[model samples]
Target: MIKIEGFQTILYSLVDVIDSGIHIIDTKGRTIVYNKKMAEIEGMESDEVLGKKIHEIFKFKEETESTLIRALHSGKKTENSKQTYFNNLGQEITTINNTFPIMDQNQRIIGAIEVAKDITNLERLIKDNILNKGDTKYTFDSIIGTSENFLEVIEKSKRSTRTTSSILIVGETGTGKELFAQSIHNGSSRSTHPFISQNCAALPDSLIEGILFGTKKGAFTGSIERPGLFEQAQGGTILLDEINSLNPNLQAKLLRALQERTIRRVGDTKDKKIDVRVIATINEDPIDAIANDHLRKDLYYRLSVVSLFIPPLRERKEDIPLLAQSFIEKFNALFELNIEGISEDVYALFYDYDWPGNVRELEHIIEGAMNLLEPGDTKISPNHLPALFKKKAHLEEAPASKDEDHNKRETQESTLSLDDYIANTEKQYLEKVLKEHGMNISQAAKTLNISRQSLQYRLKKYQVK
Candidate 1:
């Protein structure tokens, strides 16, 4: 008995040196030994806890009892169990505890030793890991492009994410402005927070105001006192899409919100503090919008704290194959098809045609092609592409009516300058895609694989609207 007690004393002495708290309780819940760390954790001296009953030494709520004492009393062992307890000072601390029966030579339970490791830091780290998952899963990997221009825009956006300044994404429709916005949000420290988007053009003036500045219940018909995007996105980001579409009055209100870092509900008297990062997207030139009285110049200057221009798909043709492959893979999963790759001829056609609709268009085309593919087919041929793709005729039919027709064509084309000819060709292509997509700018932009803002800009530039 002397030797056994001595061994336990030495064992507890060693356990006291380690940071983890250790306690040994007999079958009746009487404390046999308590390490120095355990004494410190319970706000008692080692001598005070040496032989006290665990229930008496550590106070616990009656409803939620301690597991270690219960395990000792029940002769059951518990492993790697986590619990949060408040110390005498009411400071909450998290612990990972393991309690097991200490058996004698007869293999019968004698007492139980409880080992508890403070895991407050570990829990914090786990929370951080969960929050960071959003950042890693939706960053540049989601952007998907290999073109130099596209890569440069991504690089700049990545850099911009490190700062808290406002970012204005400028591009024609279907240029993936929101994707870039999301990438930036994911890359930033604010990744854990919400990323809210509001389309400025989609809502009417009254609704847009209520949507952005939320009204109190009974302030207006159907008002339920809901939080606005800014309020909902507190400590996160708010993406104002087609910011140029906001009327001058709303533009002023937005500027005030940006400047004050607070917003009052439409009918409320109190201004709520906000910590939202603003990222605005515009399809039109801000200078032109201001000149044409579409956007307020003051608001433009405030929103354009940091500006990034995404090149149109036509400008970055090198990325077409990469974007096409990404879209093909996405559609394959969505449609449950085995479409493996685009044919060499289809790629050649993709490169030759001016992608007036941009990246969005390419995605739709791939989805359409995937939908058209037969079961077990792994390749998408040019014939699988839409008829509009083949209408250009350079890849199919030879020039009809030989020399005389060629001469007449040359004479008609020569009437316009080289710049004008290119512009006309781009305009004609955009018109065709718009017509093909039933004048739905969003759908047309996606079918063209460009941003809606970029498509809208092209429509204006080509007078297609």
Candidate 2:
């Protein structure tokens, strides 16, 4: 056995790691154990109850249902009992308890242990309907932009909500494909049903197949009858994110499900009919995807009945201010801060930077800036923004004298061809910019004066970090 100073240390570690609140009492009804989770649920420290009685910690509503006092009296088990009480700070709390007598080897009652589960907020979750909780209800107005290009995509996505046919949304990561999908579902006839989503790139083929089509009992060891995501989304929508990530074999099965409107669970011969509308997304060019054998031509046609391509944020730079303002408003209400807006310098820096992660990255930057605001701060200034932003802006607008002095040393090189020299110079500049930015992708994109997509492509082309 491993040596330790005392067994109390081992017991303390085990109690703190548990999910539920655990409390144990001795035969004398004095508290011998109270864990950290119990403290959080009770809004009191463990020291408050370490050596106290049940009456000293909380006001019990029903002594029989709420306390170990009953177990101490009867020396019998109490299963699934519930209790309600007001904490020291007057916060209403609800919890269910499982209290039972702890007996020693002599079959004599020693103490009682109670496992408490805080169900205060869970009641609200049950009322809101957990099945529909994950589904977003974004409509056409949910997308914020007025540019003609953006408006066109919105109009197409809105039109897609009018039909039950398959849809294929193609865009770079974080281009709001899920937003578009949610809008379509909320506006469709299936609005009252459910909308579920899964990322194909996140799981392996064998597991993904079972999650998509479900499994029957005896299919494998520990397998039981369960409904897959498609079944759960009946009469609604199911988005297969990064559709190209699916293995070819699974792609064939998904195509069959679409064509026949039926799916067979793993190890089950019977086919179950489903009415889930499929919306698939891919970030790469469709033609390239086909050539690379990442997607089958037939499956592509099946899902592209109403294709919607979302343009990256770089293509719609005019919307940056609007998006930033919207994020500021969201955080202002969320954080209860008095921040009004961003400064002009911040706006200029935002325009100069290429958003590689699209709208999502912009939102995160605004959130981070808002979090740094002082209690009395009115608007977000350059100092409030992340350091990466300031560095990128400085590098992009650096003095031209630095480049001028370096160019003076070149003699119109004769050894290298003109195209080769230009290519080499471009490679060296990208590497230098990337090194200066030091993993700050947003800053690097801004410094290069190019879209995040182009920067990534150039980095790959030159084999640079």
Candidate 3:
């Protein structure tokens, strides 16, 4: 038999080495052991917390919120519960905690233990990664705004962090839907696991299927056994960006995946169980998407159990300066420029203009301005703006009368050479169709009513990348 002292040494060793914070309290609510990790997380010295009464420290917090307190009073186990509060040092803390009552050989409650994993840095990383880089990234803090409408979405997302539910993020391009998805995942209980996203509109149906659900060995030439996005995201989150671009067949398959919590490799007969939370995003309104048959009704009902819309930049113009400052700071590091800020003229012009490309357009404009600035330049002025802005401003000043339409028609007629016009018009049509389908060549070709080969020839002919 192992000696009691040796056994005690092993138990204490196990507690000290683990990554999660550990706090143990006796039956009388007096702290027995506060491990190194726990001391670090609570921002206190072991001497300060050990032997202190937990009831005295957490008496006013919450009955259900504090797992240790609940276990102390009710003699019940609590698992994976989220709690947020300030520590003794006044540092705000958020953690997912698991607490249980220590039991004796006779099944009597002897003490209580609390285990917590801190994700403070993870949340910060998620926000920091999204600064002006346009990467598929975000957390609630990554999103910048104080507008009432914008903050409401943040509040809604904050509330969502408390549960595990499939969500649908609706927003136009550049409105930061992916950022919100990242924030939601980071704040969730599964924050320690992988967070993956697939752009549904970016590939053909056959390729998308293999990429998302994996492919079996010998299923097809060059196809190796693999775990698709759903399997890869087991115990975590998967974000399907542009979900409406998925074909009806894939939509049906996705519906089953969500309902059953299982997925099968592309050519495998066996099904694999997976624990994954999906967050789907769409640029269009759900009703509009369903009405157009672009998104399935059943899929909509399932994925949209929780839905959030990111207000467009035009709707939240008050946030422009804040967003611009963030972009300035970001680009300063990226371009190695020390430009301090934007000028009053540039700010005024930004307000007067309509941002067609939304926040993304603003970023591009700032980047363009930076490109023209000298090392000595400290601020972005109107003169540093793209020449197009000056031309557009002049045009905006002109009154829109019948004469304006006549002038527009005259300009359109005068600008096109017969051959150039045909080539330009064809290119415009192809580009629009390609963009509409998220650059899926097969889908774009089908919408254009042209053979894939024919569309290929035209694309090569026009040199469309």
Evaluation by lDDT, superior candidate among 1 and 3: 3
lDDT of 2 by residue, 100-199 (tens): 8889999898988988887666434334554232558677787998877789889988878878999999888988999999889998898888898888
Model 2 quality (TM-score):
0.60
Q: Compared with the true structure, what per-residue lDDT tens digits does model 3 show for residues 386-461? A: 8886676553365679988899888987888997788888888898899999999999988988656457646644
Find the candidate with the highest TM-score and give its number.
Answer: 2
Best prediction by lDDT: 2
lDDT measured at residue 106 in model 2 versus the true structure, 0 to 100: 98
In model 2, what is the error at residue 157, expressed in angstroms? Answer: 0.9
Model with the higher lDDT, candidate 2 or 3: 2
How would you encode candidate 1's per-residue C-alpha lDDT over 313-381 as one tens digit per residue? 877788887888888778768777777789998888888877778888888788877777876778999
In what order do the candidates fall by lDDT, top score first?
Answer: 2, 3, 1
| TM-score of each prediction | 0.58, 0.60, 0.57
> lDDT of each prediction vs. the true structure?
0.78, 0.81, 0.80
